[model samples]
Target: MLQRPTMPGYAAPQDLIRRVRRTWFLFFVVAIVIIAAALAGAEFYGRRSAIEALESQGRTDANLKVALLTAVLERPRALPLLLSEDQQVLDALSSANSQAIEILNRKLERLVTGTQAAVLYVVRPDGIAVSASNWREPLSFVGNDYNFRDYFRRAMEQGTAEQFALGSVSKRPGLFISRRVGSAVAPLGVVVVKMEFDRLETDWQSASRPVYVTDNHGVVLITSIPSWRFMTSGAIPQQDLASIRSSLQFGDAPLAPLPIKNPAILNPGASIVSAVLPGSGEAKYLRLLAAVPTTPWQLEYLVPIETPVASAVQTARLTALAFLLPVLAIAAFLLRRRQVSVMRIATEQAMREELERRVVERTEDLSRARDRLQAEISDHRDTEAKLQVVQQELVQANRLAILGQVAAGVAHEINQPVATIRAYADNARVFLERKQTDPVEENLGAIAALTERIGTITEELKAFARKGRVAPEPVDLRGVIEGAIVLLRSRFSGQLNALDAQLPPPGLFVMGNRIRLEQILINLLQNALEALGDRSDARVEITVTETSDEAAIAISDNGPGIPPAILDSLFTPFHTSKEQGLGLGLVISKDIVADYGGRIEVSSSDRGTCFTVYLLKAKT
Candidate 1:
């Protein structure tokens, strides 16, 4: 081997080899650490970005929901008024000749100009499209029948404004609003109003969602998303409709008429998504999907999220640059270390004179840690206090709700007898003043009978107000049923054709407070009695039947059957058919039944309305 010469201030060849090897080993270790750190940082950043992206998506969805709701709410509060105006138009059409109908339609066309409604149709109650804004066919809808629809029935039954069909008409999708024109007893007909759905569709202007409305059927009505008139025609493909039905459980059936909290504005599948829809010369792209059940229009908004491949490629390029820059800086520092070492040594000697630097850094770190711990403790205490307050509020609210239901039933029961007494007394007073001496005697007797009824009402109010603690003992089911009937007898005496009670043998007993059970019985019986209001020959049948573990009290009424829409929600709080009712009678009864480890159920048909309460049997 040839001898290698040594440079000045450098080590011998063997020593240089040893030093270089040691330095290379250290460099390799440092490089490995840097590579590991870089990988970990990249992974952490990626995970953090994903989480942030998800959070941002959630926020965007929430904001879109709010915006769609706001637009729907802003829709012409004048819808009901418009329906009323259409009633006048229809009324005029009923008597006017074709010339008059054409003239009136023209005037209406001018009135609703530039509005979301494109076409207005006045339909006859028989489902005939009577008049349109533009005259096309005279007998076009003359004999069309709409008698089988729930919307038509609703208008006739409730005599109120109602939403009807929301789909295609004359090759165009739209919404139909109708109002009963005549009396509640027998309405002349309904004033039907039709609006172009595209008008409603254009109302919603979201940039990132699919907006469309569905009828009671999962059929899509209107969407700002283009070429989606197929949904409005109620002709969605099977698979797509199935996907929508499964996710949202959509049905044409009307849900219980109870208050619905924030209903979702958009329904997925066979809906406007995954593809662009054609528009009628309006904006084509969609970002939000909004559907309004009140009308038959849905507004689809599409906002484009960045393409994943393009975004990924850009991100990777930036990431690579970030990684390469730190590595290049480390290599450059290493290459310049020799010259910098002497200056660093000098600088270190000068800076070593300061003793306070290390101490100050340690103190600052300890202060930061203490502040973080204190913030955490404060947050924990705030959460605990909020939870405690929520629990207390729930307890108080439950008590108040129960008390309110009880109070309403009591008031209703008292008012019935009081009303009868007032009628009798007023008749007696009129008889005395009319100088009819013969009938005066009968009226006086009626007044006395009415006074007795008033006394009964007072007693019932007192019993309902009783604050005594519940006392459970062996009690007769027949007695409870009869006592409740007695309290409510004045209410049903003449109103109902029969108040028959069929009880089992005297051995049927239940372990319950007599008064509370009586209250439950009265609630059920009163409901039956009230349902008999419109029946020609009203009757209520009460039967006591025994089960293996419990005794069942069944009350059946001959009034109109409970509405299918309301039957399920009847036991929920604040659900009632009566306009002035507190809607607590059935809810309180259910709670009482549950307390006894029993149940109350209802069955109804055209035959009558039947309610059965199952109570645990008392040991003899």
Candidate 2:
């Protein structure tokens, strides 16, 4: 054996083939794993992006529904509150005379037509409808008893009430907005404005996605699907159901769970669920809910998820396959080339060492330069942080300065209302002492009105001081002008009587918040009034004009005009000619106008001073 070792037996062809097959199988398995991992990563990223897009669309749709619902519901709110205090409504309720009732009914009829209200009615304390906008119709609310209705009881007790329910007579689902008439002590009646969402529902039905609104108890009050109406999103407890039934909130309709399945919450206000459509089979949907402010309701939007999910998965798989083939081929080629290049690599080993030494020297130099650059970057970042802090402080200081300037004017405006209320109260006491019931009631009403005015002024000031605001919408310029004049009436009553107003026609509108626009007008008018102070023949004029894309309002006063020295800096903050002026009025006004993409300009001379505001015209 030591002399000659027996030659090893040659491997059988079958064994050699078996080993090669096993190696190839293992290689394919690893390749499949790599391909699968890549596919999974692609799918994950694709699905996440799709979900984000769906959520964005869901939010937009939810917000749109809220706006539409708010606009429709708000149309009739002022109707009930304002009409409840109307002289005719009060007289009709107090006297119950047929003639007064007739006049009140006609007035209500006109109002209903003008406002597109479903119905406007006045219910007596006994819950009998005394006057209605549809009194002449066969289905008139007049003489109908609503004593069992929650809105009537709540309005009488709470001064105002809002309830969504099926109308007892009309048998239609609507919101009943009610306000109590007269003083709480001797309430005359309740004013009601019934608002139906038939048109809104119709519009929603035409949309691509499903939309609905649910009450506090999760009952579907308004929905795109008629069949879904009056349905509950979840089970109601026995006690709550009994209360709802007693109130007849949804008539005799059964409150059952909606036909939604397997709901998985995605976030606080968004979820994914399966729902069955009338014509279609089971489908997955992304549902989103947004709370409607000022109401105990939520707007819900449902968008189909099947298309997006399928698209995402299919796209990811195709993309992964496209990348996997090239990657696998390149890897195989590299492996073969590495084997073939072994001898060539050994031949170049010495050359590579020399190159590597030079590369190391360069690398050290680059490392040093990188450290110096990183240090510079760090210094720059520190400087930027300090600058940002200073910038924030300056912004805060500017806001405080503006607030201080307007504080005095706001106080003066509020003070006038307080004085008027005090005077009215004194007059009411005198009339009561003399046993003059009518005059005493009139004075008391005036006092109440003034108190409300004071509240409104203070609320406006508070809102102005706040940093946030509602989005601007189309605001009627004429209405804002009239509102400012009314607010300033007591301040410059004698001056306002002589002031000339040349306004555009009723519907001229600009893009801005109504309250802010009114504030601008008030500031302008107050300045004009002060300029014309103590002049017997003083004159102030407000004129509204329009171009193709802009609305211009000019406020002019005939007095010793703004001095030339201060004319250029008239709108500059803290710059004023008046002895007691903090000078933020014009600055604030300019800012407001600019926020609406408008401009303010002033021209002054010895003859007179004029301030003009230009605002973008709102699309009709």
Candidate 3:
């Protein structure tokens, strides 16, 4: 028989498909069994074990709460008993004197702070409160009568008594522990200690579990939930409710049944009960109880079991998956190995194609990298170009702004020249009429000279106002100083006459654009003139000092130096002492100087302010 042609190391298509199908069929069957077994085990045993665990924890917690309550109760229980036997309390009860009562009041006040008792007081045989710990407070118990209180009556009859009731005077509910002083035959009075459960209730709330303490009558005296207090654990008989109400012990409490429901006994001592607790909504708890020592109070602890039980079930399911997944993985590995053995030849060919694809991918990666580098380089060049444009714009703007400021002065200077030119022209016309050619020629020439002067002033202004950023070059210092003064002369006509400049030697030069250098000089000179402001004794000074590598020119003013407050911000843009000043003059000057690798320094005192401009010295 002839067989079909096959790849050297690959299985036949028909055999491969059949094996894959069988493998999937077996996997599905095994997975179904594993899941069913896991769920069944969790349902059958996990819930039972969870309940048992929670019940154990609930019992331990309940017993702990009972011990805590006992400790709180026992601490105050001795307070009244000890005070009853004390001489101070007995003396006050027997003395009936103001001095003894005052002494006992102070002692009780001090004792109450040291102990947990909210208030400690002594009552006479007739049940009138005389001396109390709260005597100093506004609602002092020093004069209150407690003859009708159940604790007072019970203690008078039995020598000692404990009762939890709402106080008639204070309106706050607390436990009253009272003890009879002296022997029953000659009883002095009752020493009563009122204890509040606020702190104990707060502790229970922190445990994150619902807890309540119910008295012999099933009325909740202390509970983690404040609203549950005075509520009964179950329904009370009409007659009993009436009797309790008549005693005036629980105040205006409704005495209704608690909101507990759906009780199911899980064990002899532990049961599951549902209740809607404050802030917790309705939930099931593992209910356990322990009697509060010496108080006929039963402490009920409720541990929420739903979360722990669900968690245990989930844990069981995970445990099952943990075992089942490994076996399935092993089976998958064996199948994978068998399949890979048959596919080795095909894998080699596929690998060759994959390698070619990777080579092509690497080439594309290189192309993308080159493209990114080119883009980054283009971005840098664009940013540099934009920076240069912005810098040129800034210099042009500052120049135009100064030119606008001095336009009026420039117009005034041109007007003077025009008036002289007109005068010379009139004279020339007269000379020509008189037939004096030489005089007419001279007059015409003078008029021409005046016009030329006007033209020169305007041309200087135009040059200052033009926009451009020029590369730094060696510039004569004298030319920059003279140029700035020429612009300011018209603006400050008389002020310029006071300028005392000590110019540097001829041929001395600094590296910077000449226009920008003149702008820096104009800013300094204009500021100094404005500061002098027509003072009779006003003086301005410009002194230039040069070194081989650097040159510094200092401009000083005798006018009241820049105000101490504004001196520091002199170079800060928009910070100005002048009410109408935009405050950009010195700032632009500082930037220009910095661009030429230079800086400006300013100093001011009571007598004067000085600004020094430093520039890099350049070869002439």
Candidate 4:
């Protein structure tokens, strides 16, 4: 079949044209879908970005307002304290007595009642009210005393006035300011200023919209919009007032305190963000809210929801048209001429080149992203490590606390024995001179016992040091108990006292660092002795009881039991009932027991106080 070269299944011109047309139809459909998707995405992202940017700007503005207000109110924070004793303002008020305060109050009422914020009161350093904006302020104030207030005293002592600042208006939403009267050298009283809702109304006139400044409390300081529902300040519901008040009085001191960072917003679900009044309910309104951390106030600017949307409508339409025109043109070009062989070839080559360029750009972007992720991980790990170190330091501090508590008794016990030893040796030297060998030997034996006691005391101290080393082993509970007794015996084994011990068998054991364990016993015993020291029938009893699973050593004294107030805080670091106490003993002892999976408890009543320590039984 040597026929002419067979062009197998090759498309004729008509068939080729039909296939090209079909491909073009499919591309046109795909292009339309892609363009629609891009426009929709752009609209969604743009709206969200716009909202976020607006909110951020609002917050910035609120912060600035709060800072300025705080700078004005700090003066008042001090005036309340200093006014009672200020010589000048007090002299002025005292000159008029009750009438003096009344007249001054009226003057202030005129100055502040119609202003943006209400003035609460102005008082002299001697604590007499000079003026007040609100009549109610006069009842509890005006000639009343302020001597007990620390704020007043500090202002006088410093002989300087506090600067203005922002705070809660009567703990509500308002602006407060105060200024000292007279000269700095011989100050008079202070001029207290407050601006509440009425004041806000004055300022609201300056703003275009129906605006109001409210605190976390729903208390409205100022508002331009007048609704019958919000006609009266007290008419506002309590919950709403509270919310607004809180928002207004937020801390303004930039250096006050940083919020906890782990979870940036301390309260979840609650809007840490500020928002516009939002039409009293869930009705959405365009609002700009700011969280002003300095004086920590929330500044809100509320507008009709329709306003922001309307303002943006014109721009939105222009952008949509701008984006849509190009997309339609590209789609149309793809549809037309697509059936031509030459056009198809060119389009295919263009698409391939575009894909290659995208691939190269994507590779570089991915590389940078990976590097950033690794660096973030490293930083996170370092932060975690630092937190762990801080936690350990806190733990070590607890250990030192207990040692510090018992140090006093330990010093007394050790020193008494040393003093007795010195006296006995000195007596022996005199006896030797008188040729009395027998008395000299007796004194020598007494000295040896005291020296041994001193050695035992030093051993207990070695365990109290805080360090990185842990040396725990099986130790006989009986021996530890007796060693503690021997160290305290010389000091407490006096004429009017009795000390007793009921130690368990030698086989009873606990696993602990020997020095630390002994130190704990000494601490408990010393506390018992001190408790019984002042009693004529002073008696201290020690009893050790054991079971298969655990062992307990109890110390009881026939003295007044632990005070109810101090019982709970006994083991807390740096807490003590004793006047001269360092307050570390129980805390250190508690930690030591916990380290070995043990516990210590104290019980007290009229019968007296008892401390019981339970240690896990070492395996036989």
Candidate 5:
């Protein structure tokens, strides 16, 4: 051991060891305190920021839902009002002529199809449904009495009325929009449009957040969760429930409080709540509400907060440690360097070298800590990115679900054409075996025509399934209608006398795909024929008319007419009355007409039914 002397202000080795130990201990204590304080502050601030972000997200979702609901609900408001002012509606209401009523029914049906309304009808002054858009469906509202409905009574008394309730016939929830027709003093009943939110609710269900719309009484009328529909946000008074029950507003639903726990009001229209989801256990959420414009309803949005909060806390801890470790290491190095300088002045070089070695070790430890913190931050970012990608996939999956719904009807439609083609081919083979070339030629021609029709139908199906649009051209209105009738001739051979067709001049044209236009006409004719099943005097009349800018094709039939029960969803996909009906005929027809800047409508009563297709005339 070489003699080592202490410099000024430097103690002996044992004393210096004690001082260094105390200094290290004090540094740790202070560093821990500082880090703890910094972590505490950071966690507090981060939690606040996360909560704010959650609230912001909830608010944005609430507003967006409100806007969507408002747009969908408001669209049909003008429809009822406009139709109420129509001269034809007033004439139909005043005259009570079966023909005029049928015509008005067709007009209303067209309006419903064009506007995508659940049902459009004109109530007589006596509160009887006179003409309805679903006149051709088994659930036609025509001839059904609606005298007891609040919307009808209110529209009769207040000039206009709006009511959200379960339809008495359809047994589904919807908003009834009604406007008084004719003069206020001599009002000729009410014009009504029912709007269903099933599609809207389906769209909402695809979102990550929980969302719903509640009426004035806090009863949830629309919700992404089907089970939550008709649930109450808060306790409902017995009297209110009784009244709602008596009115048949919600149709025998158990109006229980929503499944939420530990609700704490944070501010107006905002709350922090805990809820147990279907698959997920209890979780905290930031709940927000926004009022729907022009409606006494509020949209609620809920966002999960636990994930963000936990992430914030972890981030804060890692950041505090990251900064604190480096500072402690630097402080320790400086202290060791000072000790080395003092020792170098009086002691051997070995003592200074030992102190320098400790400094390097401390620096390396801090560097390692820093690297770990950086790795954690990178992992956090990667997790967040993955979460975003998962959200996008969820959204895309929802869209695919919609496409699947549309495609469900495809099998039914294609099956019919395929069956018809097979039947025609069999008939042609039989005729050819008998050497009846004329009949064989006729059957083959029919098969060829059907094959072409199938091609057009498949093309339309492909376009719809792909969410693509088809180009419109000048289509011969008469030719398309005749082609449709020709397709139906074999099926209606026994009732040929019952088919009445009146066509416009040969040159009449409309802006649409010819085959799609034929498809629309064929659907109407087939539906009419089916409705006229087994009736000896079953009749179907086709009339075409032209205007300066539009061409109209009216198909009227004397069938039993549509029933009121299924009228509300007459054009909805997969809704049908026939055992084999796919319920997509009217839906596809509506879509085709809409794509071509045209519309299809229907009116029905006990006397008969009529469907009208309106298309824009081709420019010369």
Candidate 6:
């Protein structure tokens, strides 16, 4: 082999080989550094996004708890105010006559039968209870002396007061609502209604979510966990504790602070804190608080953060590694190819003229290699973009779809119990509202009214069915219009103000079943009402005009006119444009009119629609 001509300071191929080794080592180190940085950034971003979602969900739960508590507290407030105004309660308080006291006791029992109140009692001016709803029980509140109770003393001076305390006789805790009878100047006695929250607490506990309510002074008044009840939310001064103890409001139990500490505030009314809930070890919780309405109380709700945050951090790190590994691999492969190219150039340079010609070819090869490398890089970048899109899709699916499926199953299993509890809440409120009126007489009258309504519905159903058809009679046209409107008003209550009815002159009659003729008009009128749903300037007009042989009653509405496509089949059975209904009204109406030797005519446009019933006139 011919050797290259040597010149002064000429480089050897051995030196270039050593340089390629050094470059490869450097590339390896750089790739490691890039991977470490990517992991760190992913972790931080993932944790921040997860925490924001956690706080938002915690706030919603807090609001629901506050609303339920407000409903429970406001129900019994009516009891004391009503009793304070009763003449029998006033007479009983003024004089301690045994017969009047007995009468008042029985009356209180009747009043509290359907209410959620734990007890309803009347207190004398000296703070002695003379009548109680539980007067017949062994632990009756008939003779309990409430002179030491803050609710009784405050009502004596302030006309009305509210206090949450433990009952001395029942040894149970409840909210006591008291209102003074008569006036502050000449006070007769006090009316007291104690409302318990056992059912409310039970419902909350069943949800397995930690929640608690605190008074203005930060003392726990209601809680899902029994161990947390009567506990202070934070530090209480010695003086305040002493005053609370002297009032005997909570009895002799120790009021220690709740088992939560070291809160790091995340936002207003939200925090991350270490809490020890019952039946679980200590964990970090995102706590949210909301103020209960109509009361000086705040509710705190807690949600654990470990499981969700950890999942987010794990998903983020895996995605980062997945994106970086392919890029690093491509870099390594390109570096290896660069080393091979350098060695090829060195070998060619030993042959002088061949080296010159190969140099140009090598330049073109390098350009082509660069273009191929760029293409490879672009392909990898596109893959990385698709990977990111897939990761986001997976994250969204895992968070919403899977969680929603589980939630739906849980909701289905617990629907009945939750509905029953809500029904109880609704019924209690309704009972209290009615009790404010003349409850005894009004309740009996309501039962009678309901019975009469049932009978009326039965009679109407029988008439609509047309069972045992009656012979045709002289049906007055005016009476038919009135009856049809009365029947239609029930379905479209509060919407009849748009109706403009024009009745026929007296003595104008038709030979048809009275109810059947009414049915024909009812169907037309009901369709007009349904068509004019919620449209502005809605109107329905009824005109009764007579020809020489037939009586025509036309019903029309200023609604979107019936479509031409369906108008041809308007009276066909089971054909309708409405979203609801059996589509039998117009068909039945057609049959009824046909049986009476009558026919229907329809005219429609974009502005309005009209259906006129033509009936044979009777010789009246």
- Report the backbone clash tally of model 6: 0
lDDT of 4 by residue, 143-202 (tens): 555443333444456643322223322433344445555557776666555444444455
lDDT of 5: 0.81
Estimated TM-score per prediction?
Answer: 0.35, 0.53, 0.46, 0.32, 0.50, 0.54
In candidate 5, how many Å is residue 85 off?
2.1
Candidates 2 and 4 compared by TM-score, better number: 2
Q: Going through the candidates in order, what is the number of backbone clashes in each?
A: 32, 0, 0, 67, 11, 0
Least lDDT summed over 10 consecutive residues: which range in candidate 1?
A: 253-262
Model 1: CA > 4 A from native: 1-116, 136-143, 148-153, 158-169, 197-220, 227-301, 307-324, 331-620
Candidate 2 per-residue lDDT over residues 465-485, each given as its tens digit: 563344679998999998777
Query: Candidate 6's error at 216, in angstroms?
Result: 1.7
Identify the leading candidate in terms of TM-score: 6
Count clashing pairs, candidate 3: 0
Displacement of residue 497 (Cα, Å) in model 3 is: 65
Q: Tens digit of lDDT per residue, candidate 5, span 1-620?
A: 12234333224576555666777688779977888898898898788888887888667767777877888987888988788888898889999989999899888878887888899988998989989999999988898888878898889999998989988888888899999987778888899999998899888866646888898999998888888889889987889877889888888888888888788898898888997667778889888889998989888888888888888787677777778789878987787667656644544344345445645778775555546545754775698689989989998999998877766756645655666677778888898899889988887887887787777777788888664668899988879987777666656667767888888888898999887787788788888888888788888998988777889899999998888777667888778999978788899889989887788777888888888899998855
lDDT of 3 by residue, 271-348 (tens): 788888876688877888788877788987788888888877876776777787888788776776675555444444
Comparing 2 with 5 on TM-score, the higher-scoring candidate is 2
Q: After superposition, how far is residue 135 of candidate 5 from its true place, in Å?
A: 2.3
lDDT by residue (1-620, candidate 6, tens digit) is 11322422234555665687678778888988898888888888778778888877767767777877888888889989998999889879887889888899998998888786889999999888999999999999988899999999999999999999988899899999999999888999999999989999998887666888888878888888999889988888889888889988899879888999999998888888999987789998888889988888889888888888887788788889988999998888787767656654675454344435545779775555556545754775698689989999998988996555444333322332233334444545577777654554554454454344444434533443442234567888899898777655544666898899998888999988776677677678878887889887999999988876789999999998889998998888568787755566677677668766789999998988999999988843
Q: Residue 475 in model 1: shift from native, Å?
A: 86
| Model 5: residue 534 alpha-carbon error in angstroms | 78
Q: What is the clash count of model 4?
A: 67
Choose the strongest candidate by lDDT.
Answer: 2
- Assess the local accuracy of residue 35 in candidate 1 as a C-alpha lDDT between 0 and 100: 62
lDDT of 6: 0.78
Q: Backbone clash tally for model 2?
A: 0
| Candidate 1 CA-lDDT value | 0.57
